[model samples]
Target: MKLERKHALVLLAIAAWNVLTYLRFIKALVDTEDRPTGYYVAHTILIVVNLLIAALLGTWGVRAYKASKASQNAQV
Candidate 1:
C-alpha cells in the first residue's frame, strides 16, 4: 500500500493534536484536588489510552512516510 504525503501529514497532525489535548486534560485534572479516587483513576486510564493512540498514530505516520519515500526512490 502506497501512502500519500497528505495522508501521512494528516496522521502526524492528529497525533500531535491528541498529545496536546491530553496535556490539557492532565492540567485540568491536576488543577482540581477535590476529585475522588475513582475520578483520578478513570482519567489516568483515559490518559494512558490516549497516549497509546497518539503513539500509534505517530508510528504509523513515520512508517508510512518512510515507505512512500522508499517506493519513490525505487521508482527512480
Candidate 2:
C-alpha cells in the first residue's frame, strides 16, 4: 500500500518511540548484571531485533515522506 504523509509520520513516531524505550531498557539491563548469562543473552538478542526493526521503520518512513514530497512538488 502507498503511504501518505500521515502514515509516514506515524511510522516515524513509532520508530522513535521504539528507540527511546529500548535504550532505557538496555540501560536497565546493564545495571542488572546479576542476571544469568542466558538471561542476558536472550535480552540482548531481543534488543538487537527491536533496534533493527526501528531502523527499518525509520528508513521506510523517510523514503515514503520524501517520495510524497517529491510527487507534490512535481505536480505543482
Candidate 3:
C-alpha cells in the first residue's frame, strides 16, 4: 500500500490541481456578474461540473493517503 516518493509526489500534484481548479471555479462564479445570461449559465454549469469532479478526485486521493499512512504505521 506504500506509494513510492515519486508516486506520492504525483498524487500530491493531482490533489493540488483539484484544489486549484475548484478555487478558480469559485472565483469565476463570483466574478460572473453583468455578463450575458447565456455566458453566465454556461460558466456556471462548467464550474459546477469541474467542482464535482474535483471533489470526487480529492476524496479518492485523501483515502489513498490515509491508507498508505495506516500501512506505514502498522509496520512500525
Winner by lDDT = 2
**Which lDDT value does model 3 have at 6?**
50
Each candidate's TM vs. the true structure?
0.90, 0.95, 0.64
Worst 10 residues of 1 by lDDT: 1-10
lDDT for each residue of candidate 1 in 1-76, tens digit (9 for 90 to 100): 7688777888899999999999999999999888789999999999999999999999999988888788889889
The numbered model that scores best in TM-score is: 2
Candidate ordering by TM-score (highest first): 2, 1, 3
**In candidate 2, what are the lDDT values of residues 15-76, reduced to their tens digit?**
99999999999999998957789999999999999999999999999999998898889889
Candidate 2 clashing pairs, residues 3+ apart or interchain: none
Identify the runs in model 2 with alpha carbons over 4 angstroms from their true place: none
Scored by lDDT, model 1 comes in at: 0.92
Model 1 CA lDDT for position 66: 84
For candidate 3, what is the TM-score?
0.64
What C-alpha root-mean-square deviation, in Å, does candidate 3 show against the real structure? 3.1
Residue-level lDDT tens digits of model 3 in 1-76? 5564456556667767877977887786787668788887887788778767766766666667777778788889
